[model samples]
Target: MAATEQQHERALEIFLDERPELRIELDHLNPLLAQAKGETAAQYRAERLHEAFEAEAERLGLFAWELTLQLTAASPQDYQAQRLEVHKEVAEMAGMTWADYCQLHDL
Candidate 1:
């Protein structure tokens, strides 16, 4: 027997959740991951999954940088300012600076 539409959607969600990297692939995944009947469908799913992974990684990186900046924005004393400076330097070294990352990603 064929699976119900709800069944298909639930299965797709489970599949994507198992591979969090593919969550971004939903834009091209037809909401239900569709029925993979042949090679082309498989290839399309793979491509979409890859795109999603890249997008999500970039988003997380930007979010981390923004959070760091907000948390360090209230340094009133000299020592606090020095510590914030050190944190910013470390984040830059790790390639997590908000301005640079956003510019690079065209975001």
Candidate 2:
């Protein structure tokens, strides 16, 4: 049970396979929250899932992608160091842990 570059790739491929649905989920994650009473300000997160995918894809020189992101906000000056989390849905399907996720991404 060794993890290799190909295994890493397969993990990411699983993510890309569900990318469209993931994008939709992000947009609809909190419809109830959006409709909840009393909040004067409306907060909607930007839909940059595509861009994030594209950037990583291009940067890695990979045509098809297999990765998902959860954001990180570090500090005022460390904005760029806020590397996004890359998920592969093994969390739900395979009962993968956060530690596993971190290990997979070399965090």
Candidate 3:
């Protein structure tokens, strides 16, 4: 099953709890990590964290959404399945067979 919003939030909480330094790095990288009206500190931090992840993903020549999926997936197998499903959808949109698309992208 796809990850829910609660799961994503929990994952982020756990990730941050495990890596306090990452929060500092994200805050440093994203100067706009300030709380908005009606937004909690956690919410602002989560938003900045996402922005930081997006920047990092772009720097690494990776898709931000895919990176998010990888980060939030329940397991490696789940991530692979979700990733393959995404590729299959993209292949369909591009009017290419899965095998051809996979080969073209070295998947």
What 10-residue stretch in candidate 2 is worst by lDDT? 64-73
Ranking by TM-score: 3, 1, 2
* TM-scores, one per candidate: 0.27, 0.22, 0.57
Candidate 3 local lDDT, 7-57, one digit each (tens): 556656655666778867755643343543456665666677777667766
Which runs in model 1 stand beyond 4 Å of their true positions?
1-15, 18-39, 62-107
TM-score of 3: 0.57
Q: Return the top candidate by lDDT.
A: 3
Clashing pairs in 1: none
Question: For candidate 1, what is the TM-score?
Answer: 0.27
Candidate 2: C-alpha RMSD after superposition? 14.5
TM-score-superior candidate, 1 or 3: 3
| Candidates, ranked, lDDT | 3, 1, 2
Q: Which runs in model 3 stand beyond 4 Å of their true positions? A: 1-19, 25-48, 59-61
Most TM-score-accurate candidate: 3
lDDT of 2 at 16: 52
**Candidate 2 Cα deviation (angstroms), residue 60:** 6.6
- Candidate 2 lDDT by residue in tens digits, 1-107: 12345644454455555577765665555656544643322243232344455576667754222322111123533322323322344344567776787586564
